[model samples]
Target: MNVDRRRRRIVVVGGGVAGVEIATSLGRRSKNDQSMPAVILVDRDSAHIWKPMLHTIAAGTRDISQQQTPYLAQARDAGFEYQPGEMCSLNRANRTIGLAPLHAPDGRLLVPAREIAYDTLVISVGSEANDFGTPGVQEYCFKIDSRLQADAFNREVRIRMLQSVAQEQDLSIAIVGGGATGVELAAELMQLTQIAEAYGAPALSSRIRITLIESGPRLLPAFPDDISQATEERLESIGIRVMTNSKVSAATTEGFELDDGPTVTASLKVWAAGVKAPAFLTNLDGLESTRGNQLVVLPSLQTTQDPNIFSLGDCSSLTLSQGERPLPPTAQVAHQQAQHLIRHLPAVISRGKRPPDFNYRDFGSLVSLAEYDAFGSLGKYGLFKGTTIRGRLAQLSHAMLYRSHQARLYGFWRGSLVWMVDRLNMRLRSAIRLD
Candidate 1:
């Protein structure tokens, strides 16, 4: 509780982008120092995968093996300890976290519930697909909130494609939510269908039907209207149906039941609607949170009630001056927050002074539709400020975003090597098939 002392131990919750970024930054920042905090990263998964690329995995465009980085390896390489345990509860008063017992596949307990004390804490447990309390959604719909969930959906798509080919019946696929995830997934599904047909599943293409259901007026509601319209046109050209202003009230065994009293039958159902922080965070002690269950944090990225506890990414909401609402849940925001905290956290750790406020820049948005096309706004360019671009340039720019994150995480040389490796792997491997 002393201000002028260094933290002996620090624990970072969540192994996603934000957590890894913060942990890696802390290691880099404290490299020259003799006395540094021992950093421990706690996550439920054994490996880390870029959440933005989940759509590609589900579409079979990118293999999970290629995209995934082992958390243990990264932690070891980055000078941190990795703990593969879920955070069950947080006792702020005691400065300890209660970890849930980890279980083996065979139902045996691997690790018992344990407590870990920390001098500083960072919670970056990312969000999950919110069903908006739709009836029967939890039971019937496939949610692409995690790698495991994405894999399951991909497998189901493969099975359905095979079934369609065997029976010569239409294989209907329905995607709920028209945000980036839903739009990108629709595009990926189209690509996967093409690949399946080219790879000895000719009958599959004719029977494959993709439908996007959005409760809003257009797809990519976060972007400009022109970009959204362009995406809609591209989807239509590829035989994917776009249903706007259609809300899914419930999910039945076969498909989604619409709020307008119509049932859309599909062989596979995907729920990408909205995002909400994990429910556990909402009821955690007296921590301040928004209506959507996101932890409310000051500009310094510290929780309102406790300066020892910091939060970032989708798990936390920081209001910005440019926008009336909180910053949108995007990888760019998380990456920026990580960079901001990395620069200022040392002062707070040593001097007990709140760091300078962080400002989030609006760098525009990009949406990729597989290999077909990409479109987005660049947010004030040259003389044409607030101009939007589309086609190849947009696609290239869209990909660079992921590369930028990799650059920060793996550094310049290693990140470039990994990027080259990904390209080589893509060329060497055969195109993935849906069947």
Candidate 2:
């Protein structure tokens, strides 16, 4: 069972922001140097989309076809192998991982279960919404965590919009979460109503009701108090009902039942309240994990159970100081962790050096609410508080974050060209996907 270690391989599980970036970065190095380890990225999906843009996709604010990058093409360009399947088991002792059998959409088996040997492993499977065992959530509520889920929501929204126009009824959507995803989606749904009207639909603005339910005191709770307040006001300005301190007891086909409150009735409901790593991570063959199923990692991003294995993004939990609280499961944290490994992994894999600790720098957060409004908290730890941005500037900065990610994946010049094409496409193509 001793697989050849002559050509070392680094198998990265999950094609998320962290996993893809690490694969691309390490793959490029091995492409240039023969001694570098081979890079293999494993994922269940064929494409990679920015996790932050899922809400937009669900709302049909942006074109999903253009926003998503095919992982096969990316792997080819970055000089890595893309293995399509989910990680089902980990053989840490054997330095191997097992991939679940691949199946076609029609339930046909395409590939049998297989195992890949790796000298080092990186787990970045990301996370999903935690419904907190709320009854009927899985059956009655929608989630926008993955691209498939987003696209499904989009299709349903388009159908509902048409039905609303025909019946002259209200199109009501209830989102149970006031975090960035919930807040941003509420805004985008408002924009969708407007866009639908432009495509020869009825005067739908007045007929669409968007309700955002938050268990906390305000929306965007991670942002500063003022920023959260401003976002709430902006959302209200757009006709979205903001329900604060309303905890959902369960989601039914009719709507969300609130604890100690009335049940908000709506056919289309979304659960986006809290986040937890995939349940599979908890059984990652004895890896130390949090109660929420996230792998507990050191500052160097190595799992406490095994140094040869590392984790990042939402699926990995790390706290720099004792009792400081684990870092938020955010795109910012994932990007920083990916870059840290990209820079240090080469030396560790090729020259056998100890991986350096990853220090996260919070450059602040920005929330862009479609074309309605935007807000930002710039600088580290408030950056003196005067660095806050709002309106157009904040929206622009928010967009640049996605562009920077593209630049990293495609290289600067190519990424710039892609951006230019997107700008031009906006002018020529329909803003919403009609199909």
Candidate 3:
């Protein structure tokens, strides 16, 4: 079972921001130099979508087709191999990972379970909402974590809107969690109602009610206090109910039951609270993990149990400073870590150099409260140190993050073309996807 010392094979699992970046970067190198390692990316889904934009899809504010990058096509363009299947097990001793059988949409088995050998493996399987085992949440609440789930929520919203118009009743949506996903979604839902009203359903706006529930005292706890306050005010101004310090005891078909407060009777319920790495990772070949199931990795982004296997994005937990506060599960962290590995991994694999520690720079965070406005504070560093941005500028900056990600994946020229096409499409089609 000995692999050729000269032949290096890198298999990246997850196809998230980190995985795609690493795969494409390595693939680009190996494409030009045949002697470089072979790069293969495996993902359960056929397409990659920016995790940040999932809420917009759920609210129908963004079109799925515009945002999704097909894995097969991206692999071809970026010079990598793409495998469409879920990773089921890790055989570190054999340097192989097991893949679950692939099936068609109609439930037909397409490919039998198999294993792929890798000299090095990068796992970026990302994370899911942590319900904290809250009773009835899994049955009664909706989560906007993936494209399919978001699309399903969009379909549900559209149906409810139609029903609301027919019955002349209010459409109440209760979102649990005050983080970016929940806050941004509340705003988008409000804006979507406006868009729906303008597009022939004039009564829709008045009938739509958005209630954002936060267990904490305020929204966006990660952001500065002022930013959180401003977000709540903005949402309140739009007639969206902002419930602070509200703890949900359980969810029901009718709505959510608050531990100490009155019942929230919502037609639709959404849970967007605490995040935990995928459950499967806890049993991932005895890798050291957090209580939340995130694979515990050193600052070098390599797992404690296996140096050959690296993990990033939400699936991995990394502590930066003395206090040992783990970095937030964010796209920013993932992007930085991916770049770090891309730069250092080659040296480690080819030159027998130790992988350098990854240092994360917080460029600050921006929260887009729908199309009307956005706000955020920039972390103090360089020329723009300690600067706070709001309004249109913040909104534009928020958008540029997604655009930058696209540029990375598709290269500058093609990504710019996409931006232009999307702008043109906005003029030609409905602001929201009707389908």
The TM-score of candidate 2 is 0.97
What does each candidate score in C-alpha RMSD? 2.9, 2.2, 2.3
Off by over 4 Å in 1: 1-7, 30-32, 380-385, 433-435
Name model 3 segments beyond 4 Å from true: 1-7, 104-106
lDDT of each: 0.84, 0.90, 0.90
- Going through the candidates in the order shown, the clash numbers are 0, 0, 1
lDDT of 2 by residue, 1-435 (tens): 111358888889998888988899888888777788888899998899999999999999889999998998998899888888898889888999988899997999998999988999999999999999999999998999999899999999989988999999887899999999999999999988888888988779988889999998888889999999999998998899999999999888889989989989887999998999999888688899999999999999999999899999999999996438999999999999999999999888778888988888888898989999999988576435548889999999999999999999999999999999999998998987788
Tens digit per residue, CA lDDT, model 3, 1-435: 122346789999998889998988888888777778889899888898999999999999999998899988888877888987889899999999999998887999998899988999999999999999999999999998888789899999999999999889888999999999999999999999999888888678888889999999999999999999989999999889999999999999999999998999999999999999888788788899999999999989999999999999999999976535999899999999999999999888888777988888888998999987899788755578667889999999999999999898888999999999999999998999787
Better of 1 and 3 by TM-score: 3
Model 1 lDDT at residue 266: 83
Taking the tens digit of each residue's C-alpha lDDT, what string does model 1 give over 1-435? 111234477789998888888887776555446366767888988888888899988888888887888887877677777887999788989999989999998999998999988889999999998998899888878988788788888888878777788878888899999999999999999999988888887667778889999998898888989898999999999989999989888888889888885788986888999999988888677899987889999888889999899999999988866667888898878888888878887777777777888888777788899999898887643465578877889888888888877887789999999999989978888777333
Query: What lDDT does model 3 reach?
Result: 0.90
| Per-prediction TM-score | 0.95, 0.97, 0.96
Q: In candidate 3, where is summed lDDT lowest over 10 consecutive residues?
A: 1-10
